[model samples]
Target: MRENSCSEPRLRKSRLGSFSKVATTKPNSNATSENRVICIYTYDWTDVADVMRIRDELRKLGITSRIPYKSDEDTMIGKYRVRGDTRISKYYE
Candidate 1:
């Protein structure tokens, strides 16, 4: 049998602020090789503004982002998830 061509993405976490944890990974698709996946965690609505600010900043820098969604993980601070990708930022592969 041929070896599996798809590989699982590796995640690296870094603290963004007092209450934010940023997890990043190299995208699996060849079309997105220049971009890295970024997941930001927020505690609640109070923290959404911060996430929005970050998202806007990334957009200004030509990075792409997506709408926030509820996370299935119960252990997450507020169960809210904000995802984005940056072209210039460095993340572990």
Candidate 2:
């Protein structure tokens, strides 16, 4: 009687090396307890400049914002909460 032998699939060394290198970041390193996060959507890379301009305008009004690398379709900007003075509609108009 003949017995069948089972063989495992082989993986390339380059593929194994690529799998070993992973991208990661520290947790909540850019967050604070007093601010709310707002995300702005952009059409493409060309719109990034306009988004940054808006960020600068917001900064002038004492509102802080940042571009988070979490997504390509949206930009994450931060806003601080102030009593009776937290608004951004005027700047958009």
Candidate 3:
């Protein structure tokens, strides 16, 4: 039982990574927290060339986009189901 508890976290982390790979970007546009995923909602309307362009913007800022496939889909603030990885990042967490 102790062994199972110790391993459960790692298993959940792996599964969660898979789930975040393809989904609507989440939360406020352009806002990022340690647990918060970056919401590049602008990419939804942006064309392919524009995506790389936007990626450049992020790279310039020093934040890597975790989920690449989410670069498009015109995700308005309300639009994204925001299934981004919800890794614990708060001080209390």
Prediction 3 TM-score vs. true: 0.33
Candidate 2 per-residue lDDT over residues 21-82, each given as its tens digit? 11123344444444434433334435555555545543554555443422332223543233
Off by over 4 Å in 1: 1-36, 41-45, 65-93
Worst ten-residue run, lDDT, model 1? 2-11
Over all chains combined, what TM-score does candidate 2 have?
Answer: 0.29
Worst 10-residue lDDT window for candidate 3 reads 15-24
Cα RMSDs of all predictions? Answer: 12.9, 19.1, 16.4
Our model 1 lands, by Cα RMSD against the true structure, at 12.9
Q: What does candidate 1's lDDT look like per residue over 1-93, in tens digits?
A: 121111111112212222223334434332334543344444443465655654554454454545443332532433221233333222211
What TM-score would every model get versus the actual structure?
A: 0.30, 0.29, 0.33
All candidates' lDDT scores?
0.35, 0.34, 0.37
How displaced is residue 14 in candidate 1, in Å? 13
Error of 2 at 39 (Å): 1.7
Q: Tell me how many clashing residue pairs each candidate has.
A: 0, 0, 2
